[model samples]
Target: MFRVLALALVLSVSFAGVVPNPATDGDRGEYVTLSVPENTSLGAYTLADGETTVRLPDRTVSGLVALAADPALARNLTDARVVRVPGFPRLANGGETLVLRRNGTVVDRLTYENAPESEVFADGGWRPLGATDFQTATASDVAVSAFALPDAPQRVLAALRGAEERVLLAGYTFSSPRVARVLAAAADRGVRVRVLVEGGPVGGVAVNSARVLGDLAAAGVEVRVFDGPRSRYAYHHAKYAVVDDRALVTSENWKPGGVGGHATRGWGVVLRNPAVADHLAAVHAADSTWRDGVAWSTYRANATFQDGAPATAAYRSDFAAWNGTADASVFVTPEDGHQTTLGVLRNASERLLVQQVHIDDARFLNATLDAARRGVRTRVLLGGAWYVREENRALVERLRTTARDEGLPLRARVVDPRSRFDHLHVKGVVTENAALVGSLNWNHESVVENREVMVQLRGGAVADYYARVFRADWRGGVWRLPLCVLAVTVGIVLGAAGVMWRRVSFSGSGRSGVPRRVPRPPSSR
Candidate 1:
């Protein structure tokens, strides 16, 4: 009698939501759902049951189906689709693996366990059966922090202030008075400070780089303009800094909007890794010493302005002390093949989450499409700025067709133009266990013909943090919430739910491709 009651209780609660055994699934076997709204039908979709497979009508079907042990439990899905497969293997109460495929192409592979209590997980956040540990990040020897616009200036300043030794900075443009003042202050303190900015106006647009370069040069900061015409690359568009063995990589220019005053939405990463710092510093050295680069004093003869003011410091930090360990490395283009970023996308077995400013390179787009073809779920959040180039807007249509006609598991969305942030200028990629963050974009010019930099981080607290940030950004933001809010929210949810956690598992092999390599450009501007 007791056994009967217990079985009844389990059955009663099973249909409430997730499968009962949530803990048994292995790391790569993380479960997910392709939510089917009411009355919607997945045309030509099929569900498999052991050696047998059943095909649902090309038309719509209404019902809930579990890839688990009990098919009856599906009746509870008032809003989910029911793919009826007679003789479908019952989902094990302990745990079961379910793979969904279409036309022999894998769609999703989910491993689920029965839950001890009733609850739901949505939008990457969890809610309890009735239930939350919120805490702050403690300082560590090797730490990483992410900063976005309207607040990047504060963090950028903090990074600058924390520098105790030499500072090397390379940017496409340098017009931010706030950042200029900070650089001047660093120089004044007897710290070796050197800067490199673009030498000439790009695409007929007059740049204030010459004036900013002159001011920094006058302030005793070693400043030079990159001689792009003599170099193999078309431009020195990479924006990054190396200070005292710490690396600051960003996808923003050094203007009031880009880094200082936070007038634009951008992404920045601070990595306390000696190897990464050394590599970036080397890149800066190479560009600074380019054969054709003219000293700021010499370039000032063609300046657009006679002078500029010392930049004021407004950068701050809401992040905890730097003390997170990461397996981080620097990847520079026109030197290295920019393989690190491509490798992350090619190796994604389960998912690829990216926020890119533009996508025009065929090879880059092909790699992403190939991953989706192999059953890797892909989501690309694109910037909505009107200036994002017409070619990219067309690429979006191509990607959409690739997903629809080829039945690939891919989705792309343009950010709402009305968001608080001006432009989504972030170039970031998050895989199951790694992340790529930096100034490299997915375009022919960026990957093949221009200088770029990025930090490739694999498995660690830092990678996890990046993945969380990507997920949140994928969901449009309210803008004012600082990074701490995400950390606290997760803590509260976990603390509230007495639920046992399971590890996520992923699987996939890596592929390699050669990007168009350009020799070092000529040495004159």
Candidate 2:
């Protein structure tokens, strides 16, 4: 009679839809994810790894659950239901099969091989959450406007203020008071304003960002944060906004240092293209509607924020918006961004100018070097900020040394800034025929983990505009002869002069006896 009752209870709460998801080998450890039916009972159920079988705990579980080798290995999945069965077989890193059974009968099974790192497998494939494929929007005579930071802050403000129907802003960080106010005002005026920002930024959330988000929430703006245990991307680092039918994409955060024109040199563009706007809007929707996305109020309810200083200094706008037309191809990271960037580099035939905070990723650096090897003149300009000085210097030296050894037409140096703007913050690529501008940093993690956006603008006018900016920044990293070379040249000149002095008498004024000041060797200005 007791066995009959137990069977009845098991039948009452079925694990009918429960199936093994693809196994994962990520930062935490190797584990198998399962799609368990909501409120499903684990009674009479067991998981098998062909060699060993262990009964699952007799409990009710719903949603995705991780059956881990070590339950503690899935600690970062705060929202997942984790289970561990004693005597369970270890999943092989190379490949493995998992079977789920109920009442000693097979219910579901999955087979996979060589699980990828830091990626979850689902729907018969392995991919990062919120990742998208490369797509291009081509329209002849499309109105595109180019602008630079600390120069045209008004362009951003004007776009937000002009919005009548909808506004969707996505960024890694948002703490700019002026931009926040504009968003609030737009919401107040009946614009359907929405914001999506990274909840777990590199250094944690800032107090000012929290404050700004809170203010926007209070103003009735729909605010969401990409956070929680099941976050799709490692970081929601894309910066762009869709205001009605216009799209504004930038390499800067919507902070005082960025759009507020206070600090950092950045590149931005406003495209009056419906297709572009629609594409970005779709991206925002996908990132914000997922399970990991949390309402601003909900995220802030239990979160503590750190104090941060806001950038306050202002500067005059030097680069005005360049109005032009171009075909734009959009790419998102952890998906097709890296490939698109590589395509741009590989296609360079005449010259390649790269301006970035830093290029730590070997793949990108190698691609740039390959361009130089192909006889394409290449110039790599890295940031000169105090924080990145040492690393940038080392990287610059390595690149220069490689160029010298290989006899490639490549030059690399740290930016001098020259007071044009504070530290280099732009992540831009200018080739002979194309320009890529967006928020993707040239790094492994950025291209493989973070949610980044980049646009390749194809047209002579657009390429020329960005190339112009690149040239200006490149000049800031002034080129000078190496100290050794300069020393050798000076030694040769001085030796020749001494030989001449011994051979011929100079008919000059007595003042000529006084040593003429030798011009100093060129500096890394």
Candidate 3:
């Protein structure tokens, strides 16, 4: 009947390329149109919900059309090609798949309503729009970018130079001279620059954080020290900044080797959401309150070089926020309770991609393993630097072997330290439709003990952008095993040095009480 034909027309036209119009209320199902192929015709389409199938009209007409199942919906899309489908029973809202068939063969399909909320659809695969996609452009309200090594420094500087108002920075360490000078300059120009640094030592590196802080202080930057007990979290491990109204979170310290120079690989995001910026500012304010906080000069006088920083207050946001069409969720460690990161891994139904500088958390490890066991295709990329502990490598190997035994599609690769950079410092995760980015590392301390910040980005350009980054790093920039064995060799060498020092110390020194060998006077003195 005409109703069947009309319904078919609606099916073909409704989803050709519908994009939500952010100018209107987001949840009202309002949408705009994108150009679809002009010559294409609706051959044969079917809408199926559970057990019912409704055959639509097979039409071969093209050109501008107007469509709406309801009058109100029709009015909103008056400018678009409209097809009036009548008597089409309301499709089940939760589970429905639209199948576009050509000559009885399916050409395209969309399965939606898998989550509790409305999903954003884009020409690019379903994912979130990242800062990189909107940094200098106006495509969307949210944007994100991922920079690795040599490229990161320049982008970071660009962010700093672009700031016009206040700059709030919190880090586990700050040792890059170039970055330091930039902060100084920003402060010199009368920008209210406040820096909160972990008042502790960084692992495996000689920390000159005191010197860095002193230089910034001398330049009029308000510098504060965060020690854990005096602060709230066990360690201030987050590396993030809120400049003007834009926010950036990265998995690198300000050390020259990590974020400034191309010596180590890392990932970062520049967010334009005011909600995110305000939340981070609030975190900075709370962490700045610990009575034990000391001036850079005072802390420097009594500092001992070591890894980790003092505990400080953390920034916790109540809920994930959205900007126009993009969805962003901010999570703070020791508070948000790993909801943002773990939720992505747990909810993955089809694919999961994880790239991290390190991974030792058993919960995260088990989640990935379980996801694979459940038939979800899982890929893991780990850091393969010389300094990477052998145990971490063993952990990855165990996962791979176990998955293989269980007949699961699980694979892992470690980035070659010798390739372009010394290590993979970027920590990120991507599911079928969501992506997570920020300073969070895949470890217990980062999740429960230390302060960390991460953003869970739902479907849009941002998620898509990071998914590409993860894929590239996995395919081109990855190396398989044998590097972990090399790490063991490095560990042995360090152990040998320790043994040699011990031998020399105990050989004849006798705790500095060895009797001096009184010279046997040349036989007849």
Candidate 4:
């Protein structure tokens, strides 16, 4: 009898320890994320919404389970186990209560109120999905080597070749054959080399990029891709590399069009600072070491690559490298990049110069306009690439119209490369006191969802260096008479010439004893 009692006691303890833990309640409206305790089987468990109860699948959950109502949301979660709970109780946006039971006994319960949209609640707080907590780092009097793209590609190549210990390259895309060759050479010299790139860029990964990554892997370089359904950021879009004690941050990709100097105007800087390099290295380690960062070979095995022609056009170098020491603050997104950049725009007391692919983000556009309204001179130069030409032209017209209507000291135009380089691919800002250069695009998604890197150089000299480049590019983007205006001007001049010819012809005809009428000149409207 005593033995039977002890067995019963042991069984009760085992069952009690197996209860599921309610970790997070993701009330993303339309769907919910049910955080199940790891290694805990839900075979005897049912989840209830105080009305209907559904039995969970009889399997051990890895960690997170999604109860999605939308089929599309279920499809997007390729990595996570999802239950399509048709008629699943909709999570009340304002508040709700959920309960989990095992064998008709309550195991866990969750109660939340005023749930924020598209955010996950856990550990007594709510945060957006994949949000990071990186803080801005300020390093004073750091040596910086600044260079402009299509002009100082060699600067990047030389930095890689000079890596004596390690090279951690992070980028949105990597397909530069020249850069690949240099990295391979560095690896062969016993320098540790690792590369991290986005596995699922827009339109999918390119065939050339896959080929380049394959070659790097074969050459003994550790190459990883930020992919899989558990990815933290929507996209790993930072374009920077940590080489030994130096960090090279840029607004361009690793493709031929970007750092290879084949095309695309960009801004880059090589910081010879240990602290900055360590900070970037830590970020790389955290990102690359995550479960979502899969090996390139593994990702390529299942990826369908898209066909693309490599950028091969060459251009003459226009700007030389500018070396100086300045106070720099490094920032990354979706953490401090947005706030730090807004600080830069809001604090501009004199003038603001911005060069970018385009400014589609309303918040940033408003900030720029607000600066102009505050008596700060503002100029925005946008890329003139074929893909963005129409949109940029339309945006330029809108800004011009607004400026004229409000009488703001703001001017915006599209760049004309003029054989200097290809389209403007720079995401840079220049003020009298500071300059920002990096991969952060001025867009809501890029600021809040994508992983980006930017550095603010706080010094007049650094600002002046980029300011000079902006001035040159601004001149290239200078507004000229529109075709219609030019056509009207030519029409007026030709009409005047014709009127003179008609008067002279009439006089000549009068001499021939026949009266003739002279045509009047056209009016200039």
Candidate 5:
């Protein structure tokens, strides 16, 4: 008892100015806490795998309290940033509340009976800050906002144009002149652009990386290729970017074929904060499992690292990682096995928000249902328009049925440019107040075949933005199709996987067609 109180006292004094914030910023994003007034009920706010239920007319509105009470809400929180809703000190309202914090200090708070954006609700343009009611500030304000891409691709390009410093991109393949130009321009202007490509050992995605590195190098970018290894696990597949403290951890490799395999589209987060950026950098640093580097003789091999820079990133002591505990929690499998992630999400106290390009595992489904039935809100966002695989269709049906039975929310999204493969292979979880990200997937390969990378980020801006993006995807962010239509259309969509599968399998053979062994130089010649 003394220990707990003593810890609190220490925290209070050391962070004397730092209040017991109801809000926290996770590596992925920031989450603000808003206390509803006594007896006022909150409309439900649902995201990919989590939900937060507000009880109105409450004596307090601690984001921490809400998340702690519900596992579903807690998983996504990762951090709780505390803010006092003014007037009622329990309620805040209005656009005027935008100034709630000035120069990083909370000042005036707004009190209102209803949401100030009521007028903008009709348009598809309204961006929710947190929940309805002028409660706490938005998840975005606490974090660097994604380029509002769902609105326009130009917005994405515009975001690229805004880069000022360093850019580290890791992807499976990249072959877009436009993208290359963008990286080149960023480099020419003095932005450091380092690219780690998954090449050779893994289906020659390295070849793809080589192509981009060559171009970027000519364009004056600092590039490097990490040749993936084939040891006891699968090849590496991680896509992300770190521009200073802002980062992007993605399921899609930023390539001409973004997220490969149309039966599913990939999803990624444009992290606009330090925590997430640093966390991702560490993850990138730890991919020692992918150490097979190949020299691309055909493509531009000039994308070599400068001699002064470190040849490889030094692995930071995992113990020294600064993941805070703010009622928000993050746990890593801490092993090569990705299946452990299922246990993490399934054990949530409030909600679990899961987004993936592909989710058809029986264990995965069982876990979701199990968590939901236990009174934990469980929501899942799966691939919709991009994939036409029969197996994927079956998984979709299973997810839908489970959602129906458990009263959990399950959604599907169609990645735009459905013709090309979309890479939505991110494996992360937002359970109540915690968020985790990595290269793990809800697939057989992820569990046994792949040696994946995953990280647990605590209390920051990245987690909240991650929560918001998950919410947006769950609410049918880009997919305009009805549920049935999406499922039905799955049978006859682009058919890229089917065609590609047939093309490769038919052209290749075994035995006599075996990879020829280099003639042993007359071992005894």
Candidate 6:
């Protein structure tokens, strides 16, 4: 029975209007019909069975299906005693009829046979926008905390605070009590706060992840949990903030434990570009269109929210200059594929420095080894927790032997994540001097499942800074340093054999292409 309830809860919360079906008009006449006004009550409704259900609230005298992008309408919706239908892409011919009734009485039967779009009820549906087309809207910002972001957050917060407008932030998780406090403070100052957490139980429903929910609530924040379906293990992990007119986007989730979670480091960017933020906010608006999913009386946010400094304190991005012109040092990783990065390093005339957490794909290993053989010096900084990701252990061991045989200078040292289990979530690729940063993970899963973004930074202080960090890790005697030094020396000597330093350079595209020949005097970028 418990299993069935849990299963039912998980499924119902997966979509919008997720309340269980009412007892039917025959059983309860205290309800109103949607279109026909025959019988409609929050007590019961028909469920699509394993798909979605529209549970009405006892307080709901009627229901409203609004799809326009209106914050006022969206925020005031929860108090309307109405069921917010989850908006989805419908397959039916441009027609969707939304009928509403109060106390078994007909109220409104709005129909749009030619809806611009309709949401096909799925386990998960996006937030609904108003019916009126939402092309453009003015923006106002609010300052939540003492810290500042690059531009978007700053401007958005400014507007919010000045205007005392409502703010809705969407991200994968929200466990930062400090952030929560800031939000709470904002609420205390009379600003409305709402967060659409990916891991919430359902639309404004809470089953688990209560700490996350509670902190925000204590701050006078209004949170709508998006339980739109998909997977119990799945979540809406996108990060963006929708202020009055702008939004913020980046690769960061708002969780305290996540920083050191399982050895994976993360990244985020405060997208100040209005157009970009607007588009992202639009997406957020679309997701919250309906009060969908099964109603969980309560939820517990698995993670905790502790006070802490911003994420940038750990992984920072500083602007650099090239050729006397200051350039923003932005390297984004769009999930997984590294063709662009590989091309840059493939053209390397001198060296390649890599620091990654895991690599289930052997091709990437071969590529690195191949670069060494072509005369370009290749160095690798591996995570100590690679064992946790054993799928690539054999490949790594094989690469070790090949490095010994060809003397192609390939060394690896795992970063001892003693303080954190396996949180080394960074992907850095360098060539002689150029560096790659952003958010791409070097794994088959990253390539296939996750969306990543990255940037190519060439010839500048950032590149040099990356090199310096590499050097410190490579030569520093932390557990993996000695092994790295030996590997570097061996790959260089074996590959180079007797080639003089002055005569050396990458064999192909400035980077040593294969494991066939040894080059000399790698050009120092």
Angstrom error of the Cα, residue 375, model 6: value is 3.9
List, residue by residue over 1-525, the lDDT tens digit for candidate 2.
999976654543222111222223433344566666668777678878788888888878887676665677554432357777566567655666778887887777777666554445556666643345546554555688888887788888987787899999999999998998989988989999999999999788999899889999999999999997756677999999999988888999989999888888999988888887898898888788865779998999989899889887655555788987888877787777467899999999998999989888888899999999999999999999988899999999999999999999999999886657777899999987789889999888898888888888888788888888878877763335556898999889777776665444443435657644343333311
Q: Write one digit per residue (lDDT tens) for candidate 3, span 1-525.
A: 999976645544334432232122432333322223455555454444346445544455566443234536535433455554443334433445545444555545655543222223445333211100111111234555444443446777777775778899888878777888888998888889999877754453245666677888989998888753324456778888988877777778877766675455666667777777887887777666544355676766766664444222111111122223456666777665466567789999988988887787878888888889888999888887666757558867887788778888999877554344555788888888787777888878777667777767677455666666667666654333356788998778777766765665556734578743443222224
The model with the greatest lDDT is: 4
Candidate that beats the other on TM-score, 4 or 5, i.e. the better one: 4
> Which window of 10 residues has the lowest lDDT sum in candidate 6?
143-152
TM-scores for every predicted model: 0.59, 0.71, 0.59, 0.71, 0.46, 0.45
* Candidate models: Cα lDDT each: 0.62, 0.79, 0.63, 0.81, 0.44, 0.44
Model 5 accuracy (lDDT, Cα): 0.44
Ranking by TM-score: 2, 4, 1, 3, 5, 6
Task: Identify the candidate with maximal TM-score.
Answer: 2
Error of 3 at 129 (Å): 38
Clashing pairs in model 2, backbone N/Cα/C closer than 3 A? 151-317
Q: Against the true structure, candidate 6 has what lDDT?
A: 0.44
lDDT of 1 at 468: 59
Better of 2 and 5 by lDDT: 2
Model 1 CA lDDT for position 141:
46
Candidate 3, residue 340: lDDT: 58
Candidate 4 per-residue C-alpha lDDT over 227-264 given as tens digits, one digit per residue, 9 for 90 to 100: 97647788999999999999999999999999998888
> What's the residue-level lDDT of 403 in candidate 5?
70
Cα RMSD of all models vs. native, in order, equals 31.0, 13.0, 18.7, 13.6, 24.1, 18.3
* Tens-digit lDDT string for candidate 5 (317-358): 111112222222111222335344665666677767877657
lDDT by residue for model 1 (1-525), tens: 999966633332112234332332231112223444345455545544344455544555334433333333443321244344434443344444455555565554445444332333433333331111111111234467766654446778778775678889988878877778888999999999999877653642134555555678889999887653334356778889888977888888887767774445566778877766776776677667644466877766655543334334233322332335556666777544446667788989888887888876667777888899999999887877778746556767778987999998998877652334556777888788777777887877777666777767666566566565556556765534456897898677665442322111112223554333333322211
